[model samples]
Target: MPLSFYGLLEASLLMLNGIAVLNRERFLKKVFSFSSLSHIKFQLIFTRFFSVPLIAINILVILFKLLVG
Candidate 1:
């Protein structure tokens, strides 16, 4: 409903997805015994590319509300 609620939800999802991407090696080891470490590394790098900006925006929004509201 509110922008703040959506921002929290998006930040949470980004955090969870970042965790999943970072730990994918452990989870995929069973299913793909031959998976390359480089692939997992790439996934982690790519996830961070998007996650950082979104999380930063969320933090900025919270701070803005607190200071200006």
Candidate 2:
């Protein structure tokens, strides 16, 4: 598998784990609905953090493949 695949998988697992732990608090769930809008917010934050670098890496991979193959 590619390095980025591992990175994505790791990040996803970590995010889920964090959500699970964060939602363990009843008050948190009541206030933030840890399973709802906050999830979307987290995804938005994560996408902003990861998408650009991920796209750049994929583009470089494609260029490398094209040059070598």
Which one is best on lDDT?
1
Each prediction's TM-score versus the true structure = 0.35, 0.46
The clash numbers for all candidates, in the given order, read 0, 0
As a TM-score, model 2 comes out at 0.46
In order, what lDDT does every prediction score?
Answer: 0.68, 0.62
Model 2: per-residue Cα lDDT at residue 61: 60
Model 2 C-alpha lDDT versus the unseen true structure: 0.62
Q: In model 1, where do residues sit more than 4 Å from their true spots?
A: 1-34, 64-69
Clashes of 2: 0
The residue pairs in collision within model 1 are: none
With candidate 1 superimposed using the best TM-score fit, by how many Å does residue 43's alpha carbon deviate from the native? 2.7
Write candidate 1's Cα lDDT for 4-67 as tens digits: 9766876786676566555555665555455487667766676778778766766876788799
Model 2 alpha-carbon miss at residue 28, Å: 20
Best by TM-score: 2
Worst 10 residues of 2 by lDDT: 20-29
